[model samples]
Target: MATSRLLRTSAAFLAATALLISGCSSGSSSPDDEASPGLTTEAGAQRPAEEATLAPLPASTPAGLRSYYDQKLTWHACGNGFQCATMKAPLDYSRPEAGDIKLAVARRKATGPGSRLGSLLVNPGGPGGSAIDYLEQYAPQPASIRARYDMAAMDPRGVDHSQPIECLSNKQMDRYTETDQTPDSPAEVNKLTTAFRDFAKGCASRSGKLLSHVSTVEAARDMDMLRAVLGDKKLNFVAASYGTFLGATYAGLYPSRVGRMVLDGAMNPELDSRTTNIEQTAGFDTAFTAFAKDCIKRKNCPLGTKSTQDAGEQLSALFKKLDAHPAATGEDRKLTESLAGTGVIAALYDQRAWPLLRDYLAQAKAGNGRGLLAFSDSYYERSPNGSYSNQMYANPAVNCLDLPPAFTSPEQVRAALPSFRKASPVFGENFAWAALNCAYWPVKPTGTAHRIEAKGAAPILVVGTTRDPATPYIWAKALASQLSSATLLTYDGDGHTAYGRGSTCIDNTINAYLLDGTVPPKHKVCK
Candidate 1:
């Protein structure tokens, strides 16, 4: 969940876990068309049975899946020092021989004398975040796990380096995001509706068939294929934000395949889009409150006086000011209220960005919006050359397809405005309207908010930061409660996620589990 729009961007309150496995067997036309792959029975051996009940084992893979499970990957030199390879999976699982999609995978080999634990797949949230970039940056997957496990990363089906989803043209996207999210006039509302309709049309035109197939459940199935191609008997994974939902789907669909999974900044799979957005609205409000409390203490704090309430009012007023008169960046870009809000939301993702946000707001108040515009630009993944990646485009595409829209129409959104306002006074109206983007989507939702009881799965660690803005903290609690074999690990701190940000307790706890079989107690809380 890349918060601001990325959380709302990807999470969109869709909770997009509408993954349906149907029978235990693959979705192939004929269950007996081919023999099932030899999946391991080891996950049940050491899995914790703390929950009242467990989900049944997934049916064995069909014979047609043999090529996918038995293919050998040829790793080669890629960017920097990491090894890279291409793995192939069927575009439609129901028709295995119809077509295929290429997946880009990158890995840093285990540098250790300790026994190799196998490949540890990692995802840095963003249903759209480039796992390749994350792995290349080496921001996640700490050294301990790296020492004994091959740190592997894969770009999901409709993400970077894979068969990515592309929507509006660069110019159209700029227009789309700049549309008044908190529309006041009827004309503005219609313009907003057009923006969404046109954007969805662009995706339908550009993405075509891929648009209908990139569900989180399908992505999870891709992961199982990746695991088999990598020659691993069990899946060892580290997923954050939306990735958590993907992992949960995997475990629920293939419980016997889960091995040493960690879901950081978990997303609750059981919550619907509106409920998810409402809760996330409150989550951001909470994070902003924390930031406001800290900001008022600093010298030259920009959001007016010391009270969080007063600070919120000041920020709200500033949004109104920008809504009327957008600020100019050094370039042609203007800081529309939407862009400014994105800037503010981007900074809220990491506590380390607050001081900079304060400075940006101060400059913005002084008629200089370069810094804040830069923040928004980064959030939008817009390049200075007026080019852009498919991140922002794919984020909503995955989100909209995974789960139904939070609000189906402008009327519905208008009706729910009060509830949204109550949830997040500063961001409610805009987010409420932003939630309407999916209403005009070209593709029907493939998933829904459902329980992910990954019964018989190995001990999975679920991490939650108390003040995580993107994926609400309570989401972790809810997810842990839903997963029959999950262990809840709480971090009472600031930031979107809690692992590998210099917290020894959190890192050690996760590392110990990845290294050995030491799951933390149910209520383990770390500072």
Candidate 2:
């Protein structure tokens, strides 16, 4: 769910040369140039598309945002012993009284004698990650932290249980996940194009009226409403990957309301879609280099190559082989370039998965790709029943709304391929085309790339992992430099996020900040 444009810069290279570049803060409008409170077809009626952009409230106090956060929430028991609630927010903030949309909220109250620090709202990076599921399955904080805070989450607008977005059926989704991300020839390119078209059509047919309204800015507004309704004096949040962008947007829109915020694996909001793709391509290439460097030093490197470049060449050859003849998984599934790439990408997210990736690649080299195929299945969140979740569907719905597509034509992308390849030779081609997903999008973007200068915001902590694949390390530095009151925390590790992933130093540092309103020293590095 993270918006990645593959870049080839290594974490070490970025760290050594990281510069504090000023982010462009100009106010830009949507491309379609539609006026505010525009009307669009909804269900059976012509309803006004929610276009109210609320200015920050007059009061500078954190409590001011909460005073406006007034709403009645109806709670119910839902999913895995968590208490879920539905709260109504205006379809458009411009007209708070016009009509309301329901937000699905879930929470597990703090257990303890510790004084409460208020609600700790959390989002797990996916533009489509189920926050409620994250809270239930992954977020088990220290008793000291848990006992003092009400851990909570919401399925952001258009996500699961919150007017969910559905694009493809089980059959269609399987085909989609199998669609070749890396197209090597004219025929492959045509196949990729058709896949994109079919995927878009499925979204159009299923999501209907909801797709247009699922941008990041809108989701940020939804967060504000959730904060208000939850009776929080200020927004306390922990967001990773794409969620970092959401939190940053919140800080930009409502600077004074930010409280105890942590943006892990921060995204670079300053980059346009093209640059984003290029940088991410390079990021994957860099990660691949790291993997290759380590793999060659191991006893069982499948490629048996002495140098990283040779390992890369070997992998590329393997992809070409797969392009001609996809490997069978010994099950109903098969391994194509796209699925294989996804399997590699899944390992890139967490350093812990590197061993598994090595073994999977070894199996794949033997013409038995079941191991890699299984890894890809987990990354896609495919179940044994072949029923896939709506993560990918909702991912694009939200992303397309957040920013405009990088390029609208394959020709334009081809023109830029040289630069993209320069940035990340390993992943440039795939990411270049992936950016085209929004080209045929049913809805138009409502925002553009700009510097987030939350001039009056509280001290926001921006955490960056040294070798994060989804959100490259430079993004953390970029975001920190852009924000007026941001403190950058560096984690020299490989993963999408640093907190709660078994780093005592990272966890303790963040916990101290959240609990005591303490900001880490500028350019603080934690190993």
Candidate 3:
């Protein structure tokens, strides 16, 4: 599983749950704005200067790619001050003449009393997450920054609107996600592997040729093209979770064009797929331990108010029970151990969902699976009507193409079980199995683990939550160290990413960077 799933799924789960529960749902460089540095104004006023400016292609650009760089975008108003447009990119960069594909783009112009600082591209991980969806529904950029930059996003190719990869039908996906990740018997193992193979075959049958070309390297190239089409001399971006990899790839590819980037919940490009999954398993363990500590402090904690070890054992016990007899949700769906684990893992992404986790756990312990099932559904991007977004399809399409599979066969996973279980007693086995999906991918791997050193890039801020469940904090430290110019900002807190989830120190420091080109001091730490 791509670690980028941390931010998008968890945040979407939070928003969806809030609707189920409550049913609800920048710019000023003036003396007044100066007095209140964070205040923002309406962007309704027209700024003719915001019109598109095509950036010049680099002198070394290949002749075949010149047209892409020179293409002009005609944006049309979508809704709520947002503009929508489409961009054309090569289906296969090596064979540009073969075909072209369209990428969906969205922009919300700067609301400003200050001169525009160009576009600020945003992406919220997922390898499969919709950048446009994030830009419209979730980005929490401060007013000061929004006032000076037109917030923009491009759904990476093979993602949401970018000619997404289609895999299994909704009914098939339901079975795939619930397929046992922890196989006790050979028959169970065969079932699991068969599901994975089916998923891979489904993608090959539907998405076909597109699968081979959706690698991160290609996505980064697409982003640079996006920057040129937006007329920005340098690309200014804020990417989280899997998006960090995309941003880092961009930096590695176009170091000279790096501008004001913030990679929150950053990923380390140096690790192989197995190591990534193992480390992510450890991350979830860390997050769950933290949750256990918090849970014990609360009165109705379902795992019992004893030690965290005991809590882990209790949760493990519950999972075992469900493995034998799946808990029935209100609907036809049952909460199997796989879905239950997904639910628990989803809640671990955000501390704000701890109470909900507690409630879900309580309900699950009592045989009601609805709560946890809801979380699993959100993680899978499964709608109430039983349709799934293409996230699962795109996620593996990108991950498998980017790196070799963690395990080539079931025997390999069984061999690694010891290390994985040591890293995460509760989640290790399942994660180890989850990593096996790519082994059955129709396309061979095109990328290998390596360090990314954006040699001449401007100082990039990388934020890491000390207890992030998806992209571990260690990745942030590693990425910051790898980048030629990077500053590590540590949030000694919980949750996936740090920028807009709530931390004045973290937010203020990032706001300064995005607004006034202020770089935070080295080794900055926020509580």
Candidate 4:
């Protein structure tokens, strides 16, 4: 799964979740911005140049793993009055005694008025997103699932609060976000490359040791460890966005261990970085078209109403203007075209933010950028105090290690511009350049694009939102088609994921499966 799922998926958590689905608003800044510090070149010097492919899992725990799987977990009160526990797993599963990573696990016991089923592990995407944070903040599963099953999650290795990955500091991030992804000239392209290079160097310096092991394959192995420690006879899960990829890996590795699983807003394991980036650009384009179609009906549509084509053209023009001369926001910071574009893209994740996007665009059109900046800030997980979460850092770290670069150089991206522009005239240039990010990654990728058949598994439910900007709906179709015994549930709507977003039909269908192990009929379509 590529980054379009976003750590704002973290930022998008109740954090951006509020901004995204609920249209939650936040205030912008006005203090003087500081210059970014020089990139550190000494952090991950000892990491192997060749990325470490995950050591193969043994058949039946390989005698060396008996202790990890048989260990008892002692749960205690943690965040939000829920139970939390710590477990240990080998850093390199192949070498059991070399070192161990501490895995953080949390759970809310079943609030049952009926018999409790096994635990249901939930991951709200972002290979970098904190699963624990999502569970405590907004818990996407229905209340009935909470009542019938112990709701739980684990922060995947190298993610927030679980030996988190650290890359650039806040000041550098400020510069990084403003660094133009869609460069129009050679100098601009060089600047963009430097930003990505520096960002990569920083992650390498700080997290070389952890970078190679943060691949989804290793994370899926961690999940199996969690499942065993939780005392579940079989794994029952609801994994969304990138989490779908993680869960699918688990099913493929341990098919008989799968119980009822829901893979919502899935990623096609078959797509390489270039294809993922191109498809994601198209996904955002589809979403923008949906937003534009609705915007034209509103009285204050800022992009104007001649047509979706005109709206895109106007939006593109505004981006160009911001690129040349940034707009001032409520904060002392100026909103460069890159930030403004990010703000626009952030809002595109959930159509609920479209009216706000229209209002913010109107503000930007009139020379104010606070609202748009706020959206960008939320997307980047930037704080009002000018601090940042490890999201931007960990996101790149995990993405780089998980897959090979989408484009190896600027020339490659340039060659692909036509296809991207054709995919999304408004957002294509940005996604195209965004694909260039992994090109300069410090660590090699441990994974590759392929299918996850999970052949002997029981029926798995896959949900797709027709107009989802991230994890395009077709991906859900592809994943469902790939998995044997998979059922595709279509949400003919706009947004990222579908289960808990006011869709009674989606919620009920998924709820039935989670609570009763009853998968919805194959290819079920819900509006």
lDDT against the true structure, per candidate, is: 0.78, 0.72, 0.83, 0.78
Q: lDDT tens string, model 3, 1-527?
A: 22223434356767977733221001111111111101111111111222121122353668898899899998999999999999999999998999999999999999998999999999988889999998898887778888999999999999989999999898888888888888999999999889888889999999999999999989999999899999989999999899999898888888889999999999878776777787778889889999999999877999999889999999999999999999999898899998999989888888888888899999999999999998888788889899999888898899999988888999999988887898888998888888888889999988887777888789999988778889888788778887889998888777788777767777888889988888877866776
TM-score computed on alpha carbons, candidate 4: 0.91
Q: What shift in Å separates residue 163 of candidate 1 from its native position after superposition? A: 0.8
Candidate 3, which ten residues in sequence have the lowest lDDT sum? Answer: 32-41
User: Least accurate stretch of 10 residues (summed lDDT) in model 2?
Assistant: 34-43
Cα error, residue 497 of model 2, in Å, equals 1.6
Residue 427 C-alpha lDDT in model 2 = 67
Whose lDDT is greatest here?
A: 3
lDDT of 2 by residue, 1-527 (tens): 12233211122111222322222221112122111111221111122233223245455424423433665787887765568888775565555555667778988777777788888998876677778777776663677777888889998888777888898889888887777776667787788778877888888898887787777777888888888777886899998778899899899888888988999888877766666666667667767887888899988998675899888888877877876788889988788877887777766766666677788888887888887777677666677788776677788787777777888877887777777666666666777778888887888888777777788889999988766777777778778877889998877756566776666767778999988888877767766
lDDT for each residue of candidate 4 in 400-502, tens digit (9 for 90 to 100): 7777888898899888888888888998888888888888887889787777788788889988777787887768877787788799888877778887776
Report how far off residue 11 is in candidate 2 (Å). 21
Which residue pairs does candidate 1 place in steric collision?
3-7, 5-9, 13-273, 18-447, 18-448, 24-59, 34-63, 35-63
Candidate order by TM-score, decreasing, is 3, 4, 1, 2
Number of the top-ranking candidate, with TM-score as the measure: 3
Query: Which stretch of 10 consecutive residues in model 4 shows the poorest summed lDDT?
Result: 36-45
Q: Give each model a TM-score.
A: 0.90, 0.87, 0.92, 0.91
